[model samples]
Each structure stands twice: as C-alpha cells, then as structure tokens.
Target: MIKKALKTAFPYSIPILTGFLFLGISYGIYMRALGFSAAYPIFMSMLIFAGSMEFVTASMLLGGFNPIGAALLTLMVNARHIFYGITMVSKYKNVGKKKWYLIFGMCDESFSINCSVEVPEGVDKGWFYFWVTLLNQSYWVLGATCGALLGSLVTFDSKGLEFVMTALFVVIFLDNWLKEKNYFSSLLGLGISLVCLVVFGAEKFLVPAMCMIFIVLSLARPHPEKEVA
Candidate 1:
C-alpha cells in the first residue's frame, strides 16, 4: 500500500519538486548571505514549513525580537490555511493518526495536489496524501541544506535571488487562474492587496490586507445555487 501510494504520489509531486528545490535553495542562500548557519535553514524548513513566511521570518529575526508582533505576523501570513483546512475537513476525515502530520505539512503545493487528485483504485488515500506532503517537504529541506552548504564555497552575485518567492507565487497564481473559472476571489485579493500595499507601505500592509480580505470574503459568500451548478 505504501509503495503504491509513493508511486502515485511521486508523479503528482514532480512540479512541486522542481519549484521547491529551486526556491528552497534560494532561501538557504539568502540566509547564508545574511550570515546565518545551515542549521537555521534545516530547522526552519522542517518546522516552520511555510516558504514565504520563512522568508519573512528571516527579515524579522534581523529586526529584533517582538514575540507579539511576530505571532500576529505569522498568523496573518498563514491565514489562508484556515480556508484550506475548512475545504479539507471532509477529505481528511478518515485519515486516522496521519491527520496530524497532514495538517502540519499542508503547505500550498501539498494542499493543491492532495485536494485535487483522486487516489487511484487500491491505493490508500491516507498514504497517498501522506506521501505527497512528506515528499514535498523533503525536497524543500534537502534543497535548503544543500544551498547552505554550497553558499560558503561559492560567492557570485545572488542579490536578486530574493525574488524567487515572488516568481513562485506568480506561477501558483497562474496555475490557479488557468484551472478555475471564477476570477472574483483572485481579482478581489489582488486588488485589495495592491491597494493596501500602496496605502500602508510594504512594512505594514499585510495585517490590513488580511483584515480586508476576511471581511470581504465573509460578506461575499457564494450562493448555494451557483456552487451547486
């Protein structure tokens, strides 16, 4: 069952494998450029596991400690997972003890593949989901570790590598845009984020953007008729 699950999950994870490896490596190099040791990347990649948040955390660490602000910032950055969890409640119901790890490791790519793919006949759904999540994270951790180790040995220009996160998000946005028919949610999010960024500036825009997003989404709940049709 596990072998079959791995085989099936591996194919679905290929795209993530490529993307995560590159982004993860870039993150590690970014941290190394900031004078952090490899331990930082390994632990953060394994534990925090939120790619964009991890990048933001690096900057926060440099800005001095503020547990309250950090906690709120982390929550705001990862607020999307609340919606992901709601959508996944039924799909994750019978997964047994694996549910804990699945929820822990349910980053964007893992959630996307696991939520969308139908497990093949005779392959256990729990195991398939577990493998997908596990493999995606493994790629990230491995890539980060490798980049950290390589960072000291090579010292070329890596100034613009920070944009890796932006490039990754753009790819994800395009993927979702191509797959879904409804643009309301996407457009609203983009518009609101842009406006907030302009008004609040980069340092303070996230909290307000999240607040606005939540308020708007709550008030704009789709009708049952449209959902069913």
Candidate 2:
C-alpha cells in the first residue's frame, strides 16, 4: 500500500510542486502589496481556505470590500465546491472521522486528486484522500508564503499578474473537459460568461453570469446519471 501510494503520488509531485509554487508566490506578492503580513497568508490558507479567494481578498482588502460582499462573491465563485462535496459524499462515506476534512479540503486541485486517482482495493481510502489533500494544501500555503516574500522584492508589472488566477482556472476547466465529462456544459459556461462579460463589464458581470449558469445548468440537469461529470 505504501509503495503504491508513493507510486501514485510520484506522477503528481511535479505538477503539485510547480503549480503551487508559482501561483502561491504570486498570491503572496499580492497579499504583501495589500498590506497583509506573513500571518495573514497562514491564517487565510488555514481558515479561509480558498485559493482564488485568497487572491481576490487581496484586492478586496485594498478596496475595502466588506465581509458580506466578500462572502457572497466567494459563494458565487466557489459554488462548485458544493457540487464536489455532493459527488464525493458517497465515495467518502468510509472515510469516517476524516469526512469533515474531506469536505474542508475540497478545493479545485484537491477535488481533482480525489476524482482522478483510483485507489487499490484494501488500501486505506481515507489516508489516500487525506494525504493528497494535505500535500496540495501544503503547496498552497507554501506558495502564498513564498509569493508574499517575492512581492516585497518585485513591485512593478503586477498588472498582468492577476491573470495567473485565470490561467489556473483554465487549466482546471481543461482537466475536467479532457475527462469527457462536463465538457459541453463548460463550453456553454464559457460562452455565456463571455457574452455576459462583454455585456455587463467585468465588475457587474460576475454575479449575473453565476446566476445564469446556476439556473441554466440546473434546469438542464446536465448528465444527471453520471455523478462524476
């Protein structure tokens, strides 16, 4: 079991390192610029626990975005986590006490790990899930800490730095798409979101797009039989 777990973890080690390092560093930079200290990132990652939200919070902090607005927006952005939990509830039943952690750690990358790996029979499913989650969250926290430090050094060219978060989303979207599940709905989401973006502009479009997607996708009942998709 240990050997197989190690073998499985091997393939993900590179991506897990690379993605988290750069992205975490970038977020750290932004957080520092927003007047957040080292403790901020640690607490945020530990408690707040949203990768994209952590980045957006930097902007929100700078802009004086209140808790209510932040919470609502966060719900909109990470609404997907709910779906991830719903799908995993059954697979995670045998997880026992670890089920809480499973729900808590259901971030984008964590979900990818949970959904992607096929556990060996008789191996501990809970431990596999826990380790994958722990590793990814470690990357995120490390990245954010590194990013905060790097932000102190590089002060310019942050204009396009925001795109890092978007790129991360694109990668996730592609990963989900390549699995041949939700590819169509994702395309529709892109189309509708783009149209909404052009129509309402960036700030105003997000809520509306989220609303539309929720209503449309829910009404469509996309691939109801296939839980993972």
The number of the candidate with the highest lDDT is 1
lDDT of 2 by residue, 27-71 (tens): 777677677787787678767677777777767877874889988
Candidate 1, which segments miss by more than 4 Å at Cα? 154-229
RMSD of each: 3.7, 4.7
The positional error of residue 229 in candidate 2, measured at the CA in angstroms, is: 18
> What are the runs in model 2 whose C-alpha is more than 4 Å off?
1-7, 63-65, 120-122, 150-229
Cα lDDT tens digits, model 1, 1-229, are: 8899999999888777777877788889999889888899889999999999999999999998799999998888888788789879999999999999999999988887787777889999999999999999999998898788885675556566555455656766778788888898889889999999999998778778878988999889888688865
Clashing pairs in 2: 24-143, 25-147, 28-147, 28-148, 29-147
Indicate the residue-level lDDT of 95 in model 2.
74
TM-score on alpha carbons, each prediction: 0.77, 0.71
- The per-model lDDT (C-alpha) reads 0.86, 0.73
